[model samples]
Every structure is written in structure tokens, then in C-alpha cells.
Target: MMGWDQLAAFVVVVAALIVVPGPSVLFVVSRGVALGRRAAVSTAVGNEAGMLVQVLLVAVGLGGIVERSALVFSVLKFAGALYLVHLGVHAWRHRKELAVTPEQERTTRSSAQILREGFIVGVSNPKGFLIFTAVLPQFVSPDSGSVPVQLLALGLICVIIALISDAAWGVLAGTVRGWLGHSPRRLSFIGGASGAVMVGLGVKLAFSSRP
Candidate 1:
């Protein structure tokens, strides 16, 4: 068990990390801009749900195996990269659809599909797995209690903070979407831009090396 002092410190560190825009944040923003607030928030929830699964795996000790094996890590990374590229290309091709009514945009994709997509992205994120493997153990106090319990607790805290932060970003982007919803051209542009961002993120992730 982590003490109040240790937990507080961990929260501060995690909050700082969450505030900085990362892959998760960017993905959520894109969803908000392209889909709407509901989709963005749902994506955030699904992403965090996937993150929670990772935390559970880490607590059970499988995370270390994935972290230590370069082949496994690379495989996961490429899978995520390819998935993002696939998503980006699909979005770009259907960008014109976004120019329709905002109501239509909101109803374009079911919540389940968006959640599934987000979950896959979250789970396949190798960087996120590495972060958990590397950071959670640092705060574990072997003498205090079970290391797995502590890791789970710390990981939950991280996810909560991220959810709140990512949701806020999504809401903000959705608001922007509302403002631009009037113009079909601008809406199409937003769709295109969001797709481009996702594609760029995928390319960047593909080139990233093990750290």
C-alpha cells in the first residue's frame, strides 16, 4: 500500500503527464472534431477502459514480459500504427459525409463502434504499455504491501486523471465543431484535417524506436 505522501506525489506526477497532450489526447480531440462531443467522451471512456485492462495485466506480472521483449513490443507498435493509418484513410475518404447535418454527424457511427476503435487503439499503444511498466513499479513499496495491489491503485489514479483531462479536450473540440457546423466546406476541412492528424500520428508512431 502506498502512503498518503507517496500517493500524493504520484498524483502530482500523473496529473502533469496527463495535462500534456499525448497520443490519447490527440485521438480524443480528433474524435470530438470529427464526430461530436458524445463520440469524443465515449472514445475517452473506451480508451481508459483499455488502459485499465493494461493495468490489470501489469499487476498480474505479464507486463514485464512484454516490456522486455523487443519483438513483442515492435509487433504491438506496428499493429497500432497500421490501425491508425487504416482509420485515417477511412476518415479521409468519407470526409464529405461530415459536411452533412450535425445531427447526422453525431449519429453517423454507433457508440459501440467508436468505443471498440478506441479500445483497440488504447490497448495496442506500445508506448502506453511501456510507460506503465516503467513508471508504476517505481512507486511500489515492497515492504509496505503487495506490489501488484500498489501498481493497480497507481494505475487507476493515472487513468482517472487521463479520463478527466482527455474528456475536457474532447468537449472543447466538440464546441469548436459546433461553431463550424454551419458551413459544409469548413466541416469537410475539419474532417480532412482530423484525418491528416491521425495519419501523421500513425507515421510518427511507425518510425518510433524502442526506448
Candidate 2:
């Protein structure tokens, strides 16, 4: 039962944050460049699914514990970073696979596997969790029907905006992939470069201090 004014403001804030091409967007773009539009879209969907779960936890009050506990935060942060690094290394090792036609490259990894990876990344991302913990409560009011319901509604709005933005980025990257599909060398280079980006993001995340 958040007020229209609060909801609108929340939407604006979420939209601004989501459109900035953060780690989540980069991950989807990487999937698009390495895999294809379908994989990218699937990854976006999966990432949102994981985000939704985080929102649920936030609504249930567990999110505060995570926000307060440095140990838990570090554990989640490192887990996500390591997973991204693992994925980047795997992609770099298979960089030549991008040389295949889009149709064939799409088959390189199953949609389920891609989705699962995206989900893991989304759920384990300490940044995402912290954002929720910090932002979601601000717009909430005691007069609202239920704090949990308000949080869920706000989180859903955030997720929808993010999914649309991430999907657009994925499609754009996929178009670039299509353009370079004709050249094996360029496709290989794209793969390596995208993988390197992921690795860099992971390293940055690993070294980032608690806020």
C-alpha cells in the first residue's frame, strides 16, 4: 500500500540504477556476445528470478542480518566473484566456439545451464543485496498495508526495469555478435574480450571494500 508518490519515486530511482550497465547488465551482455540473443534473454530472466528471491528474503527480515554481518557479506561477495571468474576462464578457454554460426553456438550451452549460472550470480551478488537492504526500506511506510508486501511491490518494480534494460543490452550485444559472426578471428577476439571483461569485473568486486 505504498503511496503513488513513493512508488513513482522508487521507480525513477530503480530505473536510473538499472540503466547504468552494472555487473548484471555486463553479465547478460557477455552471454549475448558469447552465446546469442536467446541465451542473453534467458540469462536476464534468470538473474531477475534470483533477484526476486533476494527481495523475498528482504521482506522476511533476513536481509537485515546479511547487511549487518560482514562475514556473511564477504562470503557472498567472494562466492559470486569466484563464480564469475570461473565462468570467464571457461569462456576464454572456449573462445574459438564463438566462430560457429549463431545457431550452432546457441547449442554450446543449454538454456537451463545459462539460466542457472545467471541465477547464481544474481543471488550471490552482495551489491544487489545491499541495494535492496538500503533502498527498499526508505520508501516503505508503517501506514502501508504490510511492510513485506510493500517491499515485494517495490522490488518487483525494480526487477522489471532491470530486466528490460538488461535484455536490451543483451540484444544489442547479440547484434554485434551477428555482425562479427562472419569472421572467425573477430568472433574469437570478441569472446576473449568479453571473457576478460567478466574477469575484470570479478576482480574488482573481490577487491571492493564494504560500504
Candidate 3:
């Protein structure tokens, strides 16, 4: 039941927010650089799907509960951090394999695993709850009849914007990766660098304090 004016404002705000690269963006781009555009897009979709879960919880009024519970937030954060670390370690160990033929890489790494990793990265990020709690309420009008509906609508918009924006990053990174893949030595270096980025992100997340 939000008016056009409100909807337009919300869109602008969310557009700005989505354009600011965050952890999700980093993960998607890294996957693109390491794997390819298809994997990157799949990861973006999975990440959005994971974010949808958070939106649902917020719509159902559980967002406050999550925000208030340090234990719950810590668990989610750690789960995401550990998953990223696992991915980094796996990538580092298989740098040589990464330099193999594209067909061989596809055979070794399944699409399902890539998507699952993206979903885990999405869902386990505790920061989503904070954003939902703080940002969604501002767009909800008292006369909107249903706050939950408004939250869902706004959350969907955020996710859609993010999907589009993050996909762009993926495509750009994938293109660079394609060029880099011309040489086996360069490909190996690319793999190692991507793994290091993931590990660094994981370590940063693990040590991050609650907001």
C-alpha cells in the first residue's frame, strides 16, 4: 500500500545501497573470476534466495529476536566464515586442477556445490538481519494496512536490485578471468589469488564485531 512517491524514494535508497559493494558482492565476483559467469550468476541467485529467508523471517516479526540474540548472530556469522574458509582451503589445494581445461574443471566441480556455497554465504550473513531491521521499517507506512506485506515488497525490491547489480560485477570479473585463462601459469596464479581473497574475507568476517 505504499504510494508512488514512497516507492520511488525506497528504490533510490536501495539502489544506492546495492551499488555499494559488500561481502556478497565480493563473494560473487570472486566466484566469477575463479569459475565463470554461469557460476557467478548461479551464486548470485543462491545468495538472493538465502536473503529471501531473512526477509521472510523479518516479515514474520522474528527479525527483532535475531537482532537481540548475540548467540544466534554469532552462530550465523561463524557458520558463514567457516564455509568461506573451507572454500578457500579447497581452492588453494586445487590451484593446479584449476589451471586444467574448462571441461575438466566442470567435471571436477559441480554446479550444485557452487550454488550451495553461495546460499550458505547468503544465509549465514548476520548483517542481513541488521539491514532488514533498520531499513525496512522506514519504508513502511502506518496506513499501509499490512506491515508484513510492505516489508516483503521492499525486501523483494532490494533482492532484485542486488541480483542485477551483482550479476554485472560477475560478468565483468568473468570476462577478465576468460582473458587470464589463456595461460596455464596465469590461471594457476588466478586460482591462488582468488583463494586468498576468500580466506581473507572469511577471517575478516570471523573477527567482525556485531553491529
Candidate 4:
């Protein structure tokens, strides 16, 4: 088992990592901002579950080669970027037609759908595997006793922080959306802006240098 001080330090580092605006965090926030807190949580949970698989694979060292392989990273990056672009384009196309009434938006999102969406967003991201493979091992010590346990602990910390942040975005978006229900045009613009941001991020990510 890891020492108390080590665990505490690990928690701090993991928490900071979670707070950073990475793909998972951004995906959850975007969902929350566009959907609702419940949907966000569903997405967060799914995303966490997706990440768990990556962490476990890394714990067993299955992902080490994948992480180091530029080809693998490039493939995943392009796929993820395309996914984001698709999502953005979809949002933009429908932005004008849908009325964002609370009742309507709330009714539209099933928990299952939210979870599935979150899972897809997290799984499709190539960066999470890289983080698990490259970044996670730096914190582990032979003295930690069980590397798997440590990895699990770190993954949980990340999930908790992501859930909190994403949930906040959902609540805020839902609230603002309700208040601004009268101006559908304004809401349409918001959707367009969000779509543009997603597309831009996708393009940037596709071209980003691997560490």
C-alpha cells in the first residue's frame, strides 16, 4: 500500500490533472452546457468508465507501446478530431430548429443516451490512453505495493473532479437556457458558437505535437 503522505500527494496531483482542460473535461463540460446536470453526470460516468479501461490496460503495460507509437497516436487523434467535428457540425445543423425549453431538452435526453454519448466521447479520445501510459506511471513507486491499486485510485480521483466540473457546467447551462428561452435566436447563436469551438479544438488537436 502507498504511504499516507504519498497518497495525499498523489491525490493533489491527480486533482490538478483533472482540473486541467483536457479532452474528457471539455467533453463533459460541453455536454453539461448543452444538455443538463443529469445528462452531464451520465456522460461523466461513461467517460470515467472508458478511462478505467485505458488505465487498467496501462497498469498491465498493454498500452505502453501504443502510447509510444506515433502512428497509433496519429490514428486516434485524427479519429477523435473527426468525431468532434462531426458533433459540431451536427449541432450547428440543428441549432436553429430545436427549441431549448427546459421541458423539451430535459425530455430529450435519456440517461442511457447521455451515458452512451459520454462513453463515446471518452473512448474515442486518444489522449487518455497516452496520459494513462505516460503520465500515470511517473507517480507510481515500487513502494506503493500494488501498482493496479494506485492506478485505480488515481483514475477515481480524476473521475470525481471531472464529474464535479461537468455537473457544474450542466447546471449553469440548463439554468441559463431556461432563463433565455424567450430568445431562440440567442440560443441558436450559442449553439453555433459552441459548435465552432468544438470544431476548432478538433482541428488543433489533430495537428498537435505528441509529447
Candidate 5:
């Protein structure tokens, strides 16, 4: 097993990694700004759950095996891209409905829907697989005892840090969103911009070649 110093170093690195805004974090912020902080936190929790799944899959050699196969890589990539485009379209199509109103605030997305969406994104995200496939293995050593256990420990720490950081962002976004509620026109602009970004990301993902 890695020493205390080594584990602490890994935690620091993990924290730094989470600070970089990824799709998951962006989703939470947008949801928070558009919906509420509660929704954003729920989404982040779902995202963290998805991330835990990725960590576990990688730990057991499953992620490596799938990544090693060119066919599997292509399939996963395309599938992820399709999902992204689907989400982008969904957001764009439902822009009006998602636009917050006093009454709309009374009801929010279901828990099942939140978790389902979160799990789907985590499982389907090729970039996530790529990150763990490359990053996790780098810190692991056969001499350090069970690689899987180390991975799980590292993964949990990563997820915890991300959840906290993202929740913080969600709170901040939610505050801004609350203040802007009266300005529907400005809110609309923000929503449109976020939608466009999602679509652009989907397009980029769709066209990316296997590494």
C-alpha cells in the first residue's frame, strides 16, 4: 500500500483535477441557475455517483480492457456523443418549460429522473473512461499491494472533493439566478448561451476520433 505521504499527494492532485470545470460541473451550475440550488446539488450528487461507478469499473480492470479494444472504444465514443447531442436537443427544445416561473418552482424534477440522468452520463462518458484509464494507472503500482483498493480510495476522495466544490458553485449560481429571476429577458439570453455551448460540445464529441 502507498504510504501516508503518497496518499496525501494523490488527494491534493485529485482536488486540483476537480477544480477544472468539466461537463458535469457545468451542468450543475446551469441547472442551479435555471432551476434552484437544490436541483443543482441533486445533480451533483448524481454526477458523483456516476463518477464513483467509473472509478470502480477502472479499478477492476474492466475499464482498461474495454479501452484496449478499438471496437469498444469507437462504440462507447459514438454512444456518448449521441447522448450528448440528445441532451443538447432536449435542453433546446424544452427551453421554455425549463425557464423558471413562480409556479414552476413549486415542482421540480423527480429524484429518479435526476439520478437516472446522472448515471447515464457517467456510464456513457468516454472522456471519463479515458481519464481514469490514463490517470489512475499512473499512480498505481503492483508493489503497492491491491491496485483496485488504491483506486477505490483515490476515487472516493476525488468524488468527495468534486461534490463539495460543485455544490459551492451551485450555491453561487443559484444566488445569481434568484436575483435575475425578475429579468426574464436576461435569463433567456443566459439559457440560450448555455444551450448553444452544450450543442457545440455534442458536435465536437460526435466528430472526435479514437485516440
Candidate 6:
């Protein structure tokens, strides 16, 4: 069993890591602004779902393989970045259409589509996997009896924290988008800007130097 002190310490470290804005947060914000609170929340769920999967993989030892293999890491990295860029381009192309009344927006996307996009974005993000590989094991102790179980417990904690934090960001951005929606022109601007940000994130990730 993991000690209470270890668990509390782990919580603090994870909270600190999550509060800092990262790809997941940006993705949620983009979805919030582009779609709405519903979409944002859905995306957050899907992204965390992806995080959950990565954590599970780490618990099983697959994460270490990915971390050790430069080729694998690069492949995952580029694939995720390219996907983000694709989504960004798609958003830019349909910016005018996206800037619509709330009612009309609902018709533009189904729940499943939003969920799938969020899942893909979350799963593709190599950073989450890297964090699991690098950071999750640090808090674990051999004395814990079952390292895998402890990792899973810690991972779940991380996911819960992320869902709360990222969901808040989604709600906040969605509110701003709602306010901007009063003007069709401004709505269009927000959509385009969101797309631009997504593209920039993709490009940055694609070109980032591996550690």
C-alpha cells in the first residue's frame, strides 16, 4: 500500500504540473471557443481518457519502451502534430460557417464527432505519454508492494485533477466565445483565431527538439 504522505506529495506535484498551461489545456480552450461549453467538456473527457490509457500503458511497462526509443517517440510526436495541423486547417477553412448562432452550431457537429476529436487529440499527444513515463514512476516506491497498482492510482489522480482544471478553462473560454457570438463578425474572428492557434501549436510541436 502507498503511504498517505507519498500520496499527498504526489498530489501536490501533479497539481503543479497540471496548473501550468500545456497542449491539453490549449486543446480544450480551442474547443471551448470554437464550439461551446458542451464541446469543451466533452473534449476534456476524451483527452483525459487518452491520458488514462497512457497511464495504464506505463503501468504495464510499454511506456518505458516508447521513452527509450527515439524513433517511436518521433513517430508519435509527428503524427500528433500533423493531426493538430489538419484540424487547424479544417477549422480555418470553415471559419465563416463556424461563426453561427448557438442553435446552428449544434447542427454543425454531433456529440460523437466532438468526442472522437478530443480522444484523437488526447491520444496523439506524446507529451502525456512522456510525462507518464518520466514523472509517474518517481513517486512510486518499491516498498509499495505493487508498483503497477500505485502507478494506476496516481494516474487516476492526475486525470481527475486535469479534468477539473481543463474543464474550468473550457467553461471560461466558452463563456468568452458566447459573449463574442453577439456579433457575427466577431464570432468569425474568434473561430479563425482559434484555428490559427491550433496550427501554431502543431507547428511548434512538430519542430520541437526532443530531449
Q: Say what the RMSD of model 6 is.
A: 1.1
Which residues of candidate 5, in runs, are more than 4 Å off? Answer: 106-108, 209-211
lDDT of 3 by residue, 110-177 (tens): 98988888888888877677778888898888686889988988888888988898889988888888
Task: Kindly provide the TM-score of model 1 when superposed on the true structure, using C-alpha atoms.
Answer: 0.96
Q: Give candidate 3's error at residue 142 in angstroms.
A: 3.1
The superposed Cα distance between candidate 1 and the true structure at residue 186, in angstroms, equals 0.3
Candidates 2 and 5 compared by lDDT, better number: 2
lDDT of 2 by residue, 1-211 (tens): 7667867888888788778876788999998987778888999998988888999999898999999999988999998899999989988999987787656755677889989999998888776787799988999888868888888888888888878998999998888888877888988888998889899889988999998
Residue 139 in model 6: lDDT: 85
For model 2, what is the alpha-carbon lDDT of residue 127? 62
* lDDT value, residue 54 of candidate 4: 69
Candidate 6, lDDT over the whole model? 0.85
lDDT of 5 by residue, 156-183 (tens): 7777887898788878887887887777
Cα shift from native, residue 87, model 4 (Å):
0.6
**Residue-level error in angstroms, candidate 4, position 45:** 2.4
Worst 10 residues of 2 by lDDT: 100-109
Badly placed stretches (over 4 Å) of model 2 are none
1 versus 4: better lDDT goes to: 1
lDDT of 6 by residue, 135-165 (tens): 8889888886799888888888988998999
TM-score of each: 0.96, 0.96, 0.95, 0.86, 0.86, 0.96
What is each predicted model's overall lDDT from 0 to 1? 0.86, 0.86, 0.85, 0.70, 0.73, 0.85
What is the C-alpha local distance difference test score of candidate 2? Answer: 0.86
Question: Candidate 1 on 105-205: residue-level lDDT in tens?
Answer: 55777889999988988888775687689877888889978888888888898889888988999999988998888888888889989999889888899
